[model samples]
Target chain A: AQSVTQLDSQVPVFEEAPVELRCNYSSSVSVYLFWYVQYPNQGLQLLLKYLSGSTLVKGINGFEAEFNKSQTSFHLRKPSVHISDTAEYFCAVTLSISSGSARQLTFGSGTQLTVLP
Target chain B: DVKVTQSSRYLVKRTGEKVFLECVQDMDHENMFWYRQDPGLGLRLIYFSYDVKMKEKGDIPEGYSVSREKKERFSLILESASTNQTSMYLCASSRGTSGAKRNEQFFGPGTRLTVL
Candidate 1:
């Protein structure tokens, strides 16, 4: 089984400031990592994914995440944030290719990013 | 762009009534999913179908049922609408099998259902 933990429930940052949202996971096998963002009254949109190679993966909206195997973490980072970035972010994980089931993604509780101007 | 469409944007239902939420995808994806979103709890999966007439229970499937009569359409059924069932329901579809590179699920706009 795979589970995800997003350590922070909420993060407040001033506009144009850097922000980091922490995420960790526990899985017996290799896993795929993903980040999703949800705007008010809207569905989730994929921010980025880490399938293979490149520990640092860049995503849309100038966001990026680093996949750290030793730390069992995939933390999302943005050099500068905007008011439009205020939304809910989720971290998710699924078992790697070796797992035949094409394991369903398990998501964290989510972190609400509030960009203060 | 891959589009996933839900039948209703908002619905109001009385207690004990049967509620149905429909979702359709134009991409002809092989897998479809249903989830409910609540405050603080995020999105919880109710059911998913990998193929026509095939379904699987997700994390929270106790109060709901699902149907996949065709490849592009999936429906979520509420046996008895209750106050607790009032929530934002989201539907998603993916293009390929579970482990494939196209595993990213494309989501619909969502439907807000209220049980009175």
Candidate 2:
């Protein structure tokens, strides 16, 4: 089984400032990582994913994440953030092996990102 | 433009009452899932189905049952609603293929269920 741990439960950052949301995972096998964002009263939407290839993966809204194999981390970062970026972000992972169907994702507890004016 | 729709946006149920949450996807997706989202707990899968008439239990399936009579629709049933089950329930669907791009799951707006 795989597990995800998001180190911070809440992150408050000023608008136009940089922010980073930490995520770490534990898995015996190679895994695929994902970041999802959920706005108020809405379901989650995919932010970005890291399947295989370059460690640094860019996503929508000028967000990016780096997959560090040695550290078992895929922390999400944004050089500059806007007020619209305030939302609950979740980190998830699934095994890389071929599953017969869509593999189940194990998610982190989540981090609430609040952009301060 | 994958769209996943749930039957309700908000639902109120009394304790001990039967509850059903329906989900439908129009993109002919092969897999459907039911998950509950609570504060501090990102999302916990209750059940998932890969094909019609086939269902599998997920991590937290103790208080839920699922039905998949058709490939496009999936339902989560709570035989007796409890206060503990009050949360945001989300439905998702994904392609049942063997590639990285196809692994993305599209989610519905979610149903906020409150058990009184």
- When summed lDDT is taken over every stretch of 10 residues in candidate 1 chain A, the lowest stretch is A96-105
lDDT of 1 by residue, B22-50 (tens): 99999989888898888778788888888
lDDT of 2 by residue, A1-117 (tens): 889999999999999999999999999899999999999988899999999999999999999999999999999999999999999999999888888533788889999999999
- The runs of at least 3 residues in candidate 1 whose Cα sits more than 4 Å from the true structure, single-residue gaps closed, are A98-103
Give lDDT tens digits, candidate 2, residues B65-92.
9999988999999999999999999999
True contacts kept of each: 0.33, 0.63
lDDT, candidates in the order shown: 0.90, 0.92
Model 2, position B77, has a per-residue lDDT of: 98
**Which one is best on lDDT?**
2
Could you tell me the lDDT of residue B2 within candidate 2? 90
